[model samples]
Target chain A: MSTLLAFLLSNHLKSRFVIGYTLILLLVSSALFIFTDNPQKGLLGGVNLVLLFVPLVVSLYTGISLYHGEDFTRVLLTQSLSRNQVYWSSTGSLQLSLQAALLVGLGIPLLLFAPGMPAVALLAGASILSLIFSGLSSLIAFRVNDKVKGIASLFLMWLAFTLVFDGLILLFIQLMSDYPIEAAVIFINLLNPVDMCRIVLMQVLDAAALMGLTGALLTEYMGNLFAILSVLLALLIWLIVPMELSRRSFLNKDF
Target chain B: MLHVDSLTKKFGRLEVLNSIQLEFQKGTVTGILGPNGSGKTTLIKCLLGLCHFEKGNIALNAISIKSEKEYKSYFGYMPQIGRYPENMSIGDLFELLVSLRNQPENELDLELWELFKLENIKSQRLGKLSGGTVQKVSAALAYLFKPEVIVLDEPTAGLDPLATEIMKEKIRKESSGKITLITSHILNDLDELCSHIVFLNNHKIAFSKSMKELKASRQGLTLNQIVAQLLQGEA
Candidate 1:
């Protein structure tokens, strides 16, 4: 497992795209800090851009590149390990390494800008978001088995969650113009990881913006801890269910 | 020892291997001969557990393939056409396989590596290697781990005379107390290397006989004539 991790992480670090992405994050976060009216907006924008996009893009790329060399898959089968072990180790190596990049790439800027939240809670929230997407994108890549398709799925999901979800939310707001629909919008937002990104970062960035129903519920419910824990649970389910499906498919479906 | 007992595999509607039963003895090489689309490659895939064998059990050394991974531990495979990660250098690829195999005690044979003068190309990616060189790498990797059983599909598919000789010698020398199964469209190579010939025709074994018996059955006839007679009789 350690060797697999080392093998994967070393490769990830070697990639030009990953290095470019990290540099882009460093520049954007640094520039945002310099220009914004306050640290809150800078942090929110940083989390939105760096955190969300990086995990989705990096994990998808990792899956495609990892299996591109299938001659090694045959070599692995000739060893004393089980097929399940082979798939798990390979997939786990990819997931863990990509997640590590997500951490170093995004976490550095995030901490530099927003230093209020307990490091543990911030980590928990980021992990929830990371786990959800990485597991899903990994599963999609394995099933699709083509670079174009793997990348396309990530873009499509990004479209649905980040853009389309907000469009629908606005339509609902227009429909319920007479009533205060902020509460309902909050609940609807939970369905999208983008919204969780907003709510999770809300405390660090403009605690006032979180006066909406979801934020109030989170801030008021069992405090931010409970809310973060709930999101983490939701993301954990995302990880568990899809990973189980992917593993079963990998084990039985002929590669 | 390797046993493929009544192994049946199908690809959609095509029944590739139908009740294929065979046993391989250690310290000898068995040649699998068949015309195109005669389930020779399918049998090799089934043996590697690369394809699902629907109606048969494979055993290695008395342990069922399902019960343990001893079967794979004994196998070193050279695919007919190997597609490697083009981005990786040959040395890196070799090291990667060694690491993936958990650094097995048996090292990969580099006789052909030196014979083919691949030392210069060690840092070159797999994409840069020529067809014959690729064949050498595939063959070298198959014998490299020095596994107890080796499977080569079209072992000498693309090679010059000198390289082919080097490969054949490696196959013969490495088969000591081990089994080497090779499938080839070319009969001459098999005639030179195989101790046992397992001929496939119409989804079944046309003949599984020792070299001595095959020679005896030929009655001074050439291998081609004897094989033609055997296959014609089967059809």
Candidate 2:
């Protein structure tokens, strides 16, 4: 399994898309730090960038790569390895490669400029989000065999998670504005990894003002440790469920 | 021996393979002959576990395929259309497969590799290789592991005369004590290479007979003529 992982990682890292992604992240993060007067403000700017871009980039990249790697997967399936091993190693290698890119491209600037827990939280959130999207994209790739359809579905998924989800939450809150639905809003937010990650970073930054209604309520009600732990739990679920589902589909799939 | 018992597979409501049953013994080359979309590729895929069957099981040497994946270690499968990672060089690809197999250098079969002169183009990216060259690569990889059971699907579809002859000679030499399965539309090649023939039509085996038996039954007819007569009779 490790051998397969190493082999796949080497192949992926050599691709132009991954290299270009790393360079773009490095350039953007460095420019954000160089231009902003306050590192905290730059960190906030970084948060928005990471939140908006990480899922989109990771999902599209992982999905397209999975489609492109179908031939390699077929070859591997004929080897002396179980389908489970191939599925995990391929997805695991993709997730690790993207995470490495995130760490290097964004980690260097954040550590150099905003070297604190909040910066660490931002990096952690981004890494988790990368993993979450990788799993989701793997599921999409395996579930939908047609490349164009799979990719279209991936785009729709990213849109739903990152943008449409939040809008729906806002609508739900407005409809129930009469009651004290703070706890319910927080519960609903837990379903979306993006929202959960944003809240986690906001909690770590102690920026209640920027955290919208659910984040502010979470800050007011729960202790810092409890809030972070709970959000981490939600993110962990988001991480495992998609990956497990995809793995199952891959095992039974006729390639 | 490789045994397939009552195998059935379907894509949605369309059944591709139904109740496939066959046993391949050592020292025998079985040619799988069928029209396009007659589940020839699907049968090979099922044997390699590349396709999931709804019922029945396959066993190698009395060990169930589902029991473990170790059975696959003894299989060398050459796909009909070889597809590989585009950016990977031929040398790196060979290195990866070699490392995965982890067999000793002395035991490896590099006959196809040397015959095809793949070493000369070791640095060429797989995506840049022509279809015939890719077929050469696939053939070499299948035999590199020196597997006991060899499955070649359309092995000579795009090969030039020289390469095709080389592949045929290699298959003839290596098939001495192995279970060889080859699927091809070219009956002449199958006539030259196969010891037994299994004809599939409409998702089931129409007939399976040894070369001697088939020849004895159809006195003066070649395999092509026999198949044509059979198709005409069915029509």
Candidate 3:
């Protein structure tokens, strides 16, 4: 299993795109984190970037490799490994390697910048983000035969999250400006992985900070403890939903 | 050593393989003869359990393909095209496989190293190699494991005449001792390497017989002539 993971990493690492991938994300995340007034808010921007950019980029890589690697897949499958071992081992390997790279590029630097940040909270947030995006991208990439189409779908989905989602949120807030409803805000926040990540991270910094915001809609109505825990629970759902759906498709999938 | 029974596969409304049953004897080459999109590739994929089918039972060495992992241990495969870590040197790529499989030196697939003339490019990366070279590397990797059952898809498609002869010899030798399945358009390859032929048409087994039986049935006709006789009407 470790070798399989290493094989995947080594193969992708060869593309000459991986260095640029790491550097560009590192520079952008760091710049935004440093430039913003609140590093916490900068983290929000980073979440938007990571969630949108990372899934698409990773999906493209996996899509092309899976289609082109048909020969290799044949050789490996013909060997004495059960479908269960093949499925879990390869997925396990691919997931951990990408997660490791994510840790190095994003997690390590963030921790160094914020010495006061608790390790457990930061790790939990990062793992959930990585799990949700990685599983979702891999499954989509595998389902499609055309690499370009799969990649396009990933980018478009990311675009919806990065751009259209914000626009929709603005329109909603504009309509509700007079009302300032607490329930609406909490529910809207719950629907998005990126938004859920921010609320959880910010609450970790201080539950009071989130409650003090304009309406404190979430912290005020749901109460600080419930809202914080709810965000964590939402993160769990993000990981579970994609992984389960992908797993089901993958098990019976014709590849 | 391999048996496929009533294997039927459909993708959407297109039925790829329809209730095809065939058994391969040990120590004989089974050539899957078919044209493009005639369910040749789909049958191979389903047999290997790489693709799901609506109906079928595949067994390798008497173990059900659906439930057993041991089939993997029994074979090696050379795809029509090979793609690997283009950045890693040949040695490193093979070594990674060795380590992953926990293969001892005895299990190493060095038989084709000399054939591939890989000594000069042992340190070279896969992406930098030419197409023919890439094909050679893929062939070497597939046969290196010395598996009891081997599958080669158009194994000689990109090789020079000399490399082609060497590959034919390797396939003939492997099939004589174990089980070998190959799919190819080249009738000459079957004449040179295969002991039997399994012809597929319209997602069904059109004809399956040993080379001797086929020759007896169509007395004085060549393997290509026999195949042409069977396939021309379907086409």
On DockQ, the leading prediction is 2
Model 2, span A89-164: residue lDDT tens: 8998898889989989999999998898989989988999999999999999999999999999999999998899
Residues A1-255 of candidate 1: C-alpha lDDT, one tens digit per residue: 455445545555556655675677567666776789876666656666645675566555656555564566665665666778777766776666556665676567667766666333445555666666666666776677667776788768767876788788778878988986665666676677667766776664546354365676567654777776666566566668877887776676554
lDDT of 3 by residue, A87-132 (tens): 6655665566556666666666577555455434655665676677
For model 2, the superposed segments whose C-alpha errors exceed 4 Å read B232-235
* Cα distance off (Å), candidate 2, residue A146: 1.9
DockQ of 2: 0.67
In candidate 2, the residue pairs with backbone N, CA or C atoms under 3 Å apart (3 or more residues apart, or in different chains) clash, namely none
* By TM-score: ranked, best first: 2, 3, 1
- Lowest lDDT 10-mer window, candidate 2 chain B? B62-71
lDDT of 2 at A188: 89
- Give lDDT tens digits, candidate 2, residues B15-120: 9998999999999999998777889989998899888889999999987888547888989989888888777899988888888776888899999999999999
Q: In model 3, what is the error at residue A251, expressed in angstroms? A: 2.2
Model 1 C-alpha lDDT per residue in residues B33-128, reported as the tens digit of each score: 876678887888777877677898988788777753666766788887787655457887677667766554445566776787878889987767
Ranking by DockQ: 2, 3, 1
Name the regions of candidate 1 deviating beyond 4 angstroms: A34-37, A50-52, A111-128, A144-155, A165-191, A207-225, B10-16, B33-38, B83-110, B117-135, B158-161, B186-188, B199-235
Better of 1 and 3 by TM-score: 3
User: What is residue B117's positional error in candidate 2, in angstroms?
Assistant: 0.9
